[model samples]
Structure formats: C-alpha cells, structure tokens
Target: MTYMVLLAASFGYVFLKAWQQRNVAFDHVWWVLPTSYAMAVVEVIVVTKIVMTGGNWLAVFVLGTGGGFGALTAMWFHKTFLTRRE
Candidate 1:
C-alpha cells in the first residue's frame, strides 16, 4: 500500500514537473514549483514514515525504482506530446 503511494507520488511528481517545464519553455504562465514542492513533501513524509516505522529498506528501494521509471516516463511523454510538427 505504501509502495503504491510512493509509486503514485513519484509518477505524479515527475509528470507534473516535466509538464511544467514544457509549459515554461513555451512561455506559459503555469507555475510548477508549488505543486512540485507538494509532491516532494509527499515523498519526504512517506519516506520518513517508512524509516520511523522501521519498514523494510527494500520497499524504499522499490520506491526509488518507481521514481526512476516515473522520471523516464515523464521524459518520454514530454518528447511525444510536446513536440511540434512541420
């Protein structure tokens, strides 16, 4: 369950941050920092809870793996959706 949350938070964090960067690059008014901060807070709190509760470090590893996938997916999405055609 916590792993699921971690996965989701990581995915959302990367997706939103990447989306924001795409928008910003185009001179859009969308601000990504506040929402990205919220996502970071979620990650921090979840990790803290896991550590404080003595949860398995394996789960943390899984979370990190999820985050890596999330970042990759976000990059792929940006390249796919934000690109313009001639």
Candidate 2:
C-alpha cells in the first residue's frame, strides 16, 4: 500500500543517487539520509497511530528514543566503514 510505495521510492531514490555519485567515495552516505527520513516518517506514523489507539505516552517515548538511537548507530557505522582512509 502506501507504506510499500514509500519504501520503494525511498530505496529507489537512494540507489539512483548513489549510482549518480558513484565516483565519490563518500557519496553513499547521501543514501542514508533518505533511508533515515523514511524510517523517521514511519516512526511518526506508528507513534501517531498508537496515540490514536490510546497508547501510553511512555511507550511512544521509548519507541522514539530507540528509533533515534538506531538511526544514529547506523550512520556511525556507515561513516566508519565507508569513509576513505587517509
């Protein structure tokens, strides 16, 4: 549905952008932004849905914190692994 389409489009955009900047060593990092944005959007949707269903704010806060940490960890790992060495 909409989620699937959004996922596909996000990944497609990442792939295209990466391909377009294939010559640059760190260009792939650009892909991470779109992926992160997509995930953030999904997280917001899930949180809103949960709130609408009368879920606790504590649960939403925990999920949001976890998601943010995961995204930061991913970005760190990507930078560590993909960046060119001196």
TM-score of each: 0.57, 0.39
Local error of candidate 2 at residue 22 (angstroms) = 15
Give candidate 2 regions above 4 Å deviation. 1-25, 29-53
- For candidate 1, the 10 contiguous residues with the lowest summed lDDT are 26-35
| Model 2 / residue 62 / CA error / Å | 1.6
C-alpha positional error of residue 6 in candidate 2 after TM-score superposition, expressed in Å: 19
- Candidate 1 structure quality by residue, lDDT tens digits, 1-57: 666776676666666666667757855454456756766776675666567547777
Candidate 2 lDDT tens digits, 4-77: 33334344334433433432455665665565566566556654555554656554454445445544554556
In model 1, what lDDT does residue 71 have? 74
Q: Cα miss at 9, model 2 (Å)?
A: 19
Q: What is the C-alpha local distance difference test score of candidate 1?
A: 0.66
Model 1 residue runs over 4 Å out of place are: 31-56
Question: What is the C-alpha local distance difference test score of each model?
Answer: 0.66, 0.50
Worst window of 10 by summed lDDT in candidate 2: 14-23
